[model samples]
Target chain A: MKPVIEIESISKKFLIPASSQGYQTLRESLTSLDFLRKKREFWALRDISFSMEQGETMGVIGNNGAGKTTLLKILSRITKPTSGKGRINARVASLLEVGTGFHPELTGRENIYLNGVILGLKKREIDRHFDEIVEFAGVKEFLNTPIKHYSTGMWARLAFSVAAHLDPEILLVDEVLSVGDAEFQKKSLVKMNDLSKNGRTVIFVSHNLAAVRQLCSRCMLISQGEITSIGNVNDVITEYTSFRDGDSPGTTDLTLISERKGSGIVRLTRIELRNSDEQVKGTFLMRDDLHIHLWLEAPVKVRNVKIVVDILNSFGETITSMFDSDSGFGLIEVEGSEHISITINDIRFYPGKYNISVSVISQILNHKYESFDEIENAITFDVENQLVNRNLTRRTGLLFLTPDWQIHKD
Target chain B: MAGYEIKPSGWLTFDFRELWHFRELFLFMTWRDIKVKYKQTFLGLAWVVLQPLALMAIFTVIWLKVMKPAELDIPYPLFAYSGLVFWGLFSSGISGAGESMISNANIIKKIYFPRIIIPASAALTALFDFVVTLFLLVLLILYYQIDVSLPRFAGLFSLSIMITMAASFGIGLIVSAATIRYRDFRYVMPFFLQAFFFVSPVVYPLALLSSDSLRIVLSLNPLAGAVTLARAAITGNPANWQAIFPGTLMTVFLLVAGLTLFRRNESSYSDLL
Candidate 1:
């Protein structure tokens, strides 16, 4: 089969200034010779090469800032690669974001035509699919009303409906399916499956591994702007997950992980898992006491801080979350290094691997919460069943809950 | 499936065929601009004519009462109004087109349509406004009882509007491209237009300038020639080809230079934006 999309040694470089200026005016740069000295080159993508045959659904899995969006942009022709080239041999449609070109003041009906044209459809083609789009979005009643008045969900649905109806020979999607409700996400996945089955090529970039595993025939793993592996979906995803988990489970240096976002006032310096005896351990047994130790730092005296920890199953589904506020501990003040511990009496996580994500937020003067730090899947650990000589099969679902039943003689 | 290569090309090359293929997008964008411009406004499309009419009234007072320049063959209101119709086209067209890219950065960053379509749609939207105001111009002409010369009026009117369009589009291309990198253009643009207004002879006639060299230099401004030719068309004055030729050349030069600069930076726009 002929490749529908071919990328040859493509790389993208961006210029970064050493100074922390958000944006400099031309006048300031022209007047100061120091500006020229501060400029530096930052490579966003390095030597990325790949090709996809017709009807292949290729998934791109990576951590944040792994150059996935940059690659998609290059293929979609939104920006050119600084070096190398890409050849696209089909009508291409890219959904970098849904409702990208929507005009707020335009009626839903008018926007359908406008967005359709933007997606490379002719007027008559839009007319033919107009009813289908309106029906799919379930906005037929409000078609004549301006989009500014529509609820956000309705707007996303309309935008997704239009994009889903696009009949391009090649589609480049970037995280747009995560929007709208779960029913719509399911519908979109089904629609994408249909498109692939119909022999249209697709390049899907997403962080949702489950969706990628279900939809993609092949997958590529990118790490720090380079392709680490490319082949079967399961193989690539395994490589990606293993790399993310590191060689030692439940032992991660919070400072070393670059995929974190928040204000710089507070930081999560370190994390540790401890047992009831105050000994640190990576592996725990089912029904054992699970203790999480967090080391935090604040540059200045900060108050009203709340920390949250979420336990996720192997498939990246959240099993449960613990919030500091639930214990009626409204505030914690930190000026420097401080250690906090969270102890769960019963683990109940049934003999499987699970990951933990931590987040820190603070309440401001107006009583609105501002995020201070958030790290997803920061550490992974395994749970084992230690009970012996009992015909006990490892439980099937998320947790092995202990329930007591009392029976009365009838 | 139409195949295309994504290699670096020389700065002067442009894909006019690709732009032509995306003409439907241009039309739709233009339609969107026109629709959104008047959506919530009370007067709606009337604002298109009202803006120039309001400007004409202020300029008439300033030019007639304050400057008190030398008389021409036509009424002062007619002279100022005629000049304003084209001036409005040039100024508003360039402003609209120049800001098109920055305003549509969301679309540009996501999709793969010809980038030129954005500015072109803005120019066309301004053209629609110009057409709307032309009716008011016709009413003013009839009200003032200005004699119309059919053969000369038809040819010169179209040429004048075309000249304005070309000049606006040319400048607009450069401005829109620059705006992506240097957002200071957002603040600089209004001031630049205001300064350009005085130099374009929108209120006073070009003949009011005493020195021959001064008039010739002023005529080099594309709007100067367009406004002069349009005034002549309405007032039945003989066309000044000598004065108009220099401006037409400048218009062509601006258009070529603007397009070359625009095409050179087209691919990088998304990056900067």
Candidate 2:
């Protein structure tokens, strides 16, 4: 298939505040607009290049400020690039955010025509598909009502329906799929999947890795305005997870997270997660052998040093907790500073991004010495379905396991 | 469905062919603006008539009844209403185009279009209001039994004058561009229009200011010529060509300059906004 969209080394720069304090006054704004101070140059995207075939769906994955949206804006022609150039052979439709193309005062019926025109659809084509569009949006009854009165869900559903129905050859969708309810999200997913299958070039950007994995045949991992990796969806995701997990400040960079008395006696020196190869790894699959290692220094000999590993999700919900001394429950002693290694085999977990918190504690909190050195979002892991038996089906919950099933005809 | 090719610097070069493709959209948006304006309002199109008529009444009292400036041999209401129609056209056109970018900020930031069409369409919308008020002026002319002289054809000159002043309203396009970057343009526009209203021949006829010294200065304001031409058309009188000609020239000059500024600034709009 011929490439429908070819992006050639495009970059976008923005002038953001060097100090992001509030601009509360017009005088302050005008002074800043004077341009001798306050503003700093930000390269939102830098020399990004990619090409997509007519029918390929490419997922763009990145953290916040990773230029995913900037690339999309440049491709969709909503904003001009600061440098370089890009070309697309077919029509482009973009839903960068929910309700981007909607006019609040206009009725849904009027908006359909307006949005359709915006998306490069002819009036007669919208007229022909008017019923289908309303039905798809599930706002058939309220089509005549001004959109301001519609619920956000109703607005999103109708806006997305108009955008999705345009049948544009190239579609750039940001993370706005998570706008409506779960059922609507599922329906939208199905629609996007269908669009991908139909061979229209699609560029999907979202924080939901599962959706990217499901719909995108290829993906790119961007970080700090550059493409760190690009290839198959799984490979790019693996690289991204590994990169993020590695760059997270470990126990070594504890000054930012250090909580200590003015005495300055004991401090966290380092932390390590050694797999079977003695190499640091935060990534783990379901039922994988895992190990935790730590090296610290103390002025005096410490006893009853217990290590607690708490896994937290992105929202700070603790998913699981494990105490190092719970199983072996031994009083270990360390002089000055010494490297300590702890191993746990058969780590059972789900497929998702997770955070690890490490705390050094004494079994008896009766005048405990060293406290929790803050390590936040320490690691993330993905669990894949690895089944050995043909009869075992892949399960859908946090932990994928074989469930006994019985089928009956009713 | 194909995307329009954008030149790096040329924003006002009208792609007539491309605009023609979206002609339906232009027409629909124009109609939608009109419908939404009159919808649910008790007066409906009467609001259009009321605006100029009310302004005419107030100006008549203030300029003629209160000040008793100059007789001008015509009824004050007719004179003020004539100027009010063109004044409404010019003022509303600029305000409409100035607010055009902000009001449609959602659509402007989302999709790509000939951004010029926005202000242009707003000017056209004010044209509708102007037409409705013009009908009222014709009724006034019949009631007064004004003579329709051969020079009345000079009123067609006012149509050209109306377009030129409307082009002058295209100055809002420049303001729209400025607003995208520094939103200070939004706060400054209403005050600018209000202050400009006093200088233009809206409240009083330009013919009333018959001083040889003040005539040139008043003629410099483009709306002065437009209002005078409009007054001549409705009241069946000779238009003051000396004032009207210079004002028309200024209108064309302001319009071309505004278009150039808007075109140069349009590309950076999305980035700044």
Candidate 3:
């Protein structure tokens, strides 16, 4: 079979303004339209080249901001590259996100046809698959109801349903199969697997490595806008897990982190992750003793102060929240400079990247949770598999658990 | 399903075939806009009729009573309604196209279709509203006992659509594309359309202008040509094709310029959005 997709040195450049009102207003652009001419240039994608054969499901594995989405966007023809070209010997359909063009005011049925057409399916094809989409989404009863009234899960299911039913020569999917409920996610995965089984070319980009492994015959690893490795799925994933030492930052200076907002009763100076021997580290194995160190300076004595640390997965979805008190576990009062190290005994996160976010809150003025300081995605680390048969090929899902299993004959 | 190629950004890459493939999406987007524009309102599609009908009624009374016409053989309401029909098309098309990019930013960022589809469909939705009002214009013509040749009326009607759509699409294309890169174009559109209304012969006659230079200057506005064409078609009045020629020429220029600008900026929409 011929290669369905062939790329040659594709790259994308973006002009980030040095400073402005964020969006280019008419007044500013009228006065200085050329202000971005001498601005800092960012290469979101850099000279990327790859090729894929027909019926091959290629998995794209990369760290956050590794140009995975940029690659997909280039392939999908949403954005043009600064240089280079790609030749595709198949009709391409890309689902960068579910419900990419769904109208909230329209009913579910209308959205299916609308989104289906937007995804490059013909109106007759949508009419042919109309019943199947309704059945798959399990929203047949609410098909006539506007999508805005549907629950988030229902919305997601219907969106996925329309895209899952698409029959294209090649499909470029990005991080969509990983979303939705577990049961629905499994169904979507099975649909994707079927698509490849029918000899359709698929390029899947997902943070959920397990889904990628299940659906992709080959895997590609991209780091810092370049392909570091591409070949067998197992080999690439192993390389990905091993190449994380320098990628995750161990020490994060929080004072300089601008992604924070608060009323300022306290100031967070720094945050650090430490291993069992009190050595600063970013990569940790499952069931390891993880200590979160927080350095803070308080101006006044704060009463009923509670600190919450959120552990988020690679997609920035909160996996777990650890705190001094979830509900009245005794809020502590603090004044002046203080250092607190919260030790998580036998942390059980599965193999993946994770980020830490901290929130300092106090119940000030009649039971209102007033925030003193907060920062998100400030510190990040990688979790390596730490068990027998420790293959990183399958990301296995978050929160590694050792539930006792017993078999009984009925 | 055959093959395709992704090339570097060109000076102009207006793919007509790709736009044709997205025809269903165009229809749906236009229908979607029409459905959503009046969704959850007390009078949904009725507003399509009520708006123009009310405007024509108010303008007819004011024109005859307050600002009396210098020379008019035809009924005032018929004359007023004919101009309102196409004027609605121009105003809605410009505003619709101007805001189409911003309103569909989410879709533009996620999916890949010709970016022109959004503004073009928005213009079509405006045309849909105008079509509804055309029924009223027909009734006004018959009510006023105007003589309209069936053969000539059809050609004029189609010409009026082409000019109005071309003018709106031409200017709207630029407004919509410019709005994406520089949001100032968003504010400029409403002000431009408001000013354009005074220049067009919407509620008044071009003949009333005593100065030949002023009449020619006003006729250069594309809507003036469309309105004049539409009025002549419905009432069987003689049309000055010369006065309408420059505006028609400007319409073609704007459309070409608009398409060039839109196609140049189309690939960067997802990045900027």
Could you give candidate 1's per-residue lDDT for residues A191-223 as a string of tens digits? 999999999899999877888989999999887
Query: What docking tier does model 3 reach?
Result: medium
Over the stretch A1-410, how does candidate 3's per-residue lDDT look in tens digits? Answer: 67889999988887876553446776665677766556778787888888998899999987656788988988988888988898999888999999988888899998998888888888998999999989988998998999999998999999998898788899999988766788888888888999999999999998676677678899998876788889998788667644234334678777765435576678788889999999999889888999999998888888777788888765435788877765445447778988988888898887887878788887546757788888765577788885948665334566678899999999
**Clash tally, candidates in order:** 0, 1, 0
What are the fnat scores of the candidates, in the order listed? 0.70, 0.30, 0.86
- Using TM-score as the yardstick, the better of models 2 and 3 is 3
Candidate 1: C-alpha RMSD to true structure equals 3.1
Per-prediction DockQ = 0.64, 0.21, 0.68
Best by TM-score: 1
- DockQ order, best first, reads 3, 1, 2
lDDT of 1 by residue, B1-273 (tens): 376776543454676788788888988999999999999999999998888888889877887789866878788777887888888889888899899998998899998887888998999999999999999888888898877988889899999999999999999998988887778988999999999998888888787788998888988999998988888888777888898999999999999988888888988888887
Over the stretch B1-273, how does candidate 3's per-residue lDDT look in tens digits?
A: 477788788776666786777888899899889888889999878888888789889988888789866776577777777777788898899889989999898888777788888999999999999888888877877777878899999999889889999999888888888888888777777788778777778888888899999998988888888878877787677877987888899999999999888887888888887
Score candidate 2 by DockQ: 0.21
TM-score between model 1 and native: 0.92
Off by over 4 Å in 1: A243-248, A259-269, A291-311, A320-345, A357-375, A387-395, A408-410, B8-12, B211-213
In model 3, which runs have C-alpha deviations exceeding 4 angstroms? Answer: A20-22, A243-271, A275-289, A294-341, A345-410
Candidate 3: what lDDT?
Answer: 0.83
